[model samples]
Target: MNHFPLFADLKGRRVLVVGAGPVADRKIALLLAAGARVVVGARAAHPRVLARAHAGEIDLRLGEFNPAWLDDAWLAIAATDDRALNRKVSEAAAARRLFCNVVDDPELSSVQVPAIVDRSPVTIAISSGGSAPVIARRLRERIESLFDHSLGALADLARRRRPAIRAARPGLRARRAFYDWLLDGPVLGALRRGRPDEAERLLDEALAQAAAPPRGRVLLVGAGPGDPGLLTLRGLRALNEADVILHDRLVDAGVLSLARRDALLIDVGKAPGGRHEATQARIHALMVSHARQGRCVVRLKGGDPLVFGRGGEELQHLRRHGIDYEVVPGITAALACGAYAGIPLTHRDHAQSLTLATAHRRGGACADAEPESGRTRAYYMGVERLAGLRAQLLAGGLAPDTPCAIVENGSRSGQRALYATLENVENQARRHAIRSPALIIVGEVAALGRELAWFGEILDGEPATAATARLAAA
Candidate 1:
């Protein structure tokens, strides 16, 4: 470490700022937020600084560079355009044994300010030892997105209950376990939902039952359709807290990478036409076994678990065994595929309603649900059943020329959107060799994809016409 990082307590302490520019104003604001008694010694004060001085918020001494200003200061900051003056302030502070920071001159300063992500009581500081401040700031930005405003409230709750928690569970291990429950259980959920009273009650209830062994729980998380960025915040939290993750084969590797590094990952994915019932039974057994051991189990499924992911069956199995569980919804393929393909599922001018269905059903039978006219229809896992789907929709009264789009590998790299009408959709699929993990969109709005297709335009791959050549041939 080039510099030893330490958070100073500036509450009621005098800090001197030797400039009146925007940079000095920023440092003064941070100091004031930390309750510092700011003393500004500058040739001329910035408008904001002058305003604060007039309001008696800070002490302002308008003058030339003076070493006398460092007399009673605990810390000093020199943020000026003049290099000589900034170095003079740094030398004066060094003589007085005070830590000073020179803006844009790291070598001349005794201290450097770090990039901060403030969740109040849970503030995170990132420092690059003044060697790479931009990199430090970028790192902080990435970390800041993972945490929300509720983290500070959660910290406050913990602080207020520390005394009671210590009294209830005096043993360090037991107390730590209690805190884990507080953070990973319903108390944190209540806090996230903006229910502080409920959070408090939940915490109290858990503390009252701290003597008992912690119960295991399961969270059914939707990993979204291939893209990790589409995963919900709550789903990400569940993955991070999981002791064991039962993930599907289709769940993107990017999504799995976000889980706790040490988490036990079990592939519970059932291959198409491969002993489906046996695979499902094994999934149920694994969830029950791990959860019974008081482990935090995550059932990570691709897309919205409830929509064709057999999430309902798993939920029923958990309920039958009396296991505690919660569900986190993900972006299903129909929604993600439609947006990425630029085919709005519902448009007032083209489609007033939307219908989601599956073309491929159990036992190789076409799903009996018929697509109605006027509403946009999206079919999941329909790549193989394109001909059957087209026939069924036509029989159900959709026009032969109704526009359609086949979105393959939706929301992922190498994603392709093939545009065609109902009459030639099956031909287009066969010509382009469209595969599974693709969605079938049928409606007047599907035609709009040709004009509004944005993702394809930006991506550096095959042109949209390459996939839609069959339509052009027709």
Candidate 2:
């Protein structure tokens, strides 16, 4: 973010390069290709520079560096070996209010040239603000490999057919969909197969055909915990294709950023002290309304939507309205927290089964809840009701010494796991000031967090008051 990325229109402009080395030669070649009027200034000119000058391809001055060389120059590049000389050029360009690049010198340069992947009319630039050029170059190579060379031809076709595309699909949403089809469908395939005529004919026929109106559909996408990397590929695709995204508050900003730039983002997460049911109703309404408008709506929830995420409720509502929808499941908190905390939920020596439970119910905590023998019970959203849950477990003949672990911000960089026992879980949670969005695991496997913890901090058994853990919920 340190450098603002831009695609400057250097065509028909003048540029000055104050070096004759290979580095300068490379920069000069790129500038010339960009249609810049190149002027080379160096005490000793390279053979290539001399040849370009002799061929009237460039205006070359063989002499000491001069400030006058930057006159009428739209941009300047100082690629010389002398740091002082490059600094001088940078200062001179700064005085003229012209952007300049000091090769390999971030402090002296006003702008850093980025590594590029050029699919002409669709150029992608990667930069580390001149801090890590090698990394940028590596990224460029990866991007280059992912895109086909014929992509430029596809872009050219799109450019030529834009007018017809607009006329055929006047609606903005429909137009965008059509453009997506052009990229993903047979048009790009035809061009990639080196059949330009076939590609053009396909485009013409697609535009000539009576296009169906865009249909609205809902996609339930699971955003796993707080890590963007944990998102499923199907979830990522749903996000990119969404016209409207209604996401939970727990959904990370990094996850939301993966969606289309123009997609409308709405936070539909219920907040503390808010009417939960009403909030859910509003979310349902929003989804239905947007889908009815023929827009692709995405209900993005953290963790598996069906696993205590109320995804089933949303699906039922969609079905009542006969709306089209798809589900992309995500890694639930129980699984994520256990793995991240290095506590296997179903260790053969500890637990025989796994129970996914909610701490609070509509009627309140299930007072008569029974703990199954040798089962690992993962309590969702249970941080605030730990005391009540502890009492219920104890009343139901659960062992007082049964091990427990509270995982906060699971799967995230700031994750913390607090290990305690059923008898002391409430006390330990109170001492730690555990917050919501935390998951509670009650079983012998929970004790493994202390010895097996890997991803985050672990708060083990301690008697000191100052050693309080801060376990916050999502």
Candidate 3:
């Protein structure tokens, strides 16, 4: 590193700022936050600086730059636009052996402020050696995304219990392992889930028996609708920290690739016309077994787990097994597909409410759940049963001309939206060879997709006359 990076302790120390413009005001604010005594020497000052002076937060001296300003300062900052004045400040600080930062003039600055991501007790700083500040800022943004805000709490808790932790794990290696467990295991997870008491209990439990086998837990995380970008931050963190992952087959490969490199991946997906009950039993067994072995188990499923994804059943199974678990919600297919296909499930003019159902329920049971007038209906697994759905809707006295849409692959890059009327929906499915993993939407709002659709291909399955009329209206 060309410049040594260190966090200075300036608490109650005098720091001199040469110039009181906006830039100086910003530096002074940082100085004040760091508990530094600030003395400003400038030809003029920003109104905020004057206000701070009046408030006695900073001592403002309005006059020409003076070398005497650096006499007692622990650090100096030159933020003036004038190059000569900045150089003078830099040279004076150099003569006094005081570190100085000349704003926007890296060559003259002995200290360069780095972009900071402050999770309080857990702060991260990024610098490009004063050569690429923008790059440093971008790096800071990525770090901010990767770390949870609860990290500060986790850090503080560790600090408070450091003596206990040290006593529990006397060896250096043992202490390091304990710290790793604190970071990757249930303690941090508990904090992230907003159970600080539980987190404290878990930490205490660990400290009580530091040599015992680590406790295991399960995180049921939603992978979202086929798009990795839709995955939640908590879900990503779980995947990265997982020791074992029991994932559905439909979970995106891109999502799987984000897991810990050494994590064991087990496919527990069930298929139609397959032994689903047995498969579900096996999944439950795997989750319980891995977690019992002190592994961080992730039951990764596509879309929101509770929304017809059997998440509730899995949670029930986990509870029955006495396994510690947390649920991370994902963007459900109904919402993701509706947004991607530009079909608002509920619109003021077209639809007042939305009904979600599955097509495979016996005896046309889902038909009873059909949306009323001025409402929209979405079927999760109906692409294969479109003809039966159409017939059921007709038998239920629904309008033959009701707009329908089939959203395939939802938010994926290859997603497609096929539009048709209730009467012709079956025909359109047959013509387009529509497949499973598609959502079916029915209502007047489905018709608005043709006009509002922005992402993916839109296929019109309406009759030529109707299509011509709609196009003319547009």
Candidate 4:
């Protein structure tokens, strides 16, 4: 964010380069390609510069660096090895109020060149503010592989049909919908297969059908457990396409940042002591209302929506209303919490089975089930009921010394894991001042966390107030 990215109109503009070496040669080539009238001033001109000058491709002046060379220039570049000469060029450009780039010296340059992926009319530029040029180039190379040479042809096709498409679909929304169809339909496929005629035909057919109203749909997306990286590609697509997003409070800001900037976001998460039924009713109403308006609606839920996330109710409601919908699954908390805490849910030697449950219902009633032997149990939102849950397990003939771990803010920067026995889990959590949005793991595998821990190195029987441990965990 240190620099605002912009595409300057340098076509038919005057540009000055203060060197004729390899560095200056590269800059001049780029300037010429951009349609800039480049002038190279150097005491000794490079062979390529002389050739270009002879061919009348560029203006070459054989002389030492001079402030007069910057006259009538829209942009200036100092690429000579002499630091003093580069500094002089920069100062002259500044006095003339012209933007200048000093080769390999970002501190003196007004603008730094970016690594670009060129698809002619479509260009993607990436810059690390001149701090990491190699990294920027690496990123550009990765992006280059995802796109093919056919993209230039695709852009050309779009440019040619824009006027006709706009005239056929007067509404902006309808026009955008037609383009989306064109890109996702057989037109793009035909282009990729090197059949331009077929692509144009498909485009014509789509344009003919643009008068029809666009269909509305719903996408049920899982935001995953705290980490944005865990979000699926399909989920990201749904977010970008959504006209409105209904998100839960537990969905992190990082995940929400991926959605369309102009998309309306509605928080449907139930607050403490809030009526669950009424909130659910409101969510249902919002989904139906938005979809009926021919808009794309996204119901974003934390973790896998189907796993105790009440996604079934929403799906049933959508089905009853005959709304088109798709579900994109996400990594649930059980997996994220266990991995981040360095505790596996199932181990061949320790746990052969796993059980996921909640300690309390939505109404705050104790829904604790007896802890089955030889099975790993993960309890969601159970930190507040640790005491009651522990008592219930003990009453059910569970061992008092059963290993347990409480993972707070799992997969997040503030994550903490406290390992203790079932008998003292409540005390350990209280001593460490544990909070909600935590998962409790109980099984023999929980004891393995002390040794198998990789993410954070907090050991069992150790005090949780160690600053180094928290920093490492973060």
- RMSD of each candidate relative to the true structure: 8.3, 4.0, 9.8, 4.1
Q: Give TM per candidate.
A: 0.62, 0.93, 0.60, 0.90
Between candidates 2 and 4, name the one with more favorable TM-score: 2
Q: How far off is residue 46 in model 4, in Å?
A: 2.4
In model 3, which regions exceed 4 Å deviation? Answer: 1-213, 362-364, 369-371, 463-474
How many backbone clashes are present in model 1? 0
Q: Per-residue lDDT tens digits of candidate 1, residues 351-420?
A: 8888788876777776544556558888888887788878877887777777888898899986888887
Model 3 scores worst on lDDT over the 10 consecutive residues at 362-371
Q: What 10-residue stretch in candidate 1 is worst by lDDT? A: 457-466
The stretch of ten residues in a row with the least summed lDDT in candidate 2 is: 465-474
Q: State each model's CA lDDT, in order.
A: 0.86, 0.88, 0.88, 0.86
Question: What does the lDDT read for residue 113 in candidate 3?
Answer: 85
What tens-digit string does per-residue lDDT give for candidate 2 at 1-474?
Answer: 577888889998999999988898899888888899999999888888788889988898888999999999999999999998999999999999999999998999999899989899788889998998999999998999999888899999999888989999899888888888888899899988999999999999988887788899999999998899999998998998999999998899999999999999999998877899999999999999999999999999999989998899999999999899999999999999999998899977768998899987887956345767668999998887778888888999898877788999998878888888888888778887778779998887877676678898888744322122211110
Q: Write the per-residue lDDT of candidate 3 for residues 1-474, one digit (tens) a residue.
A: 588889988999999999999999999998998899999999999999999999999999999998998878999999999999999999999999999999888999999988899887777889887889899999998889989899999999999999999888876546766898998899999999999999999999888873855678999999999999899999998997788999998899989999988889999888878998899989989989988887789999989888888889999998998999999999999999999999989987768888888887655565554437888988888877777788888788788888889999999888889988898988888898877789999888888788788999888898657844643553
Deviation from truth (RMSD, Å), model 1: 8.3
Better of 3 and 4 by TM-score: 4
- The best candidate by TM-score is 2
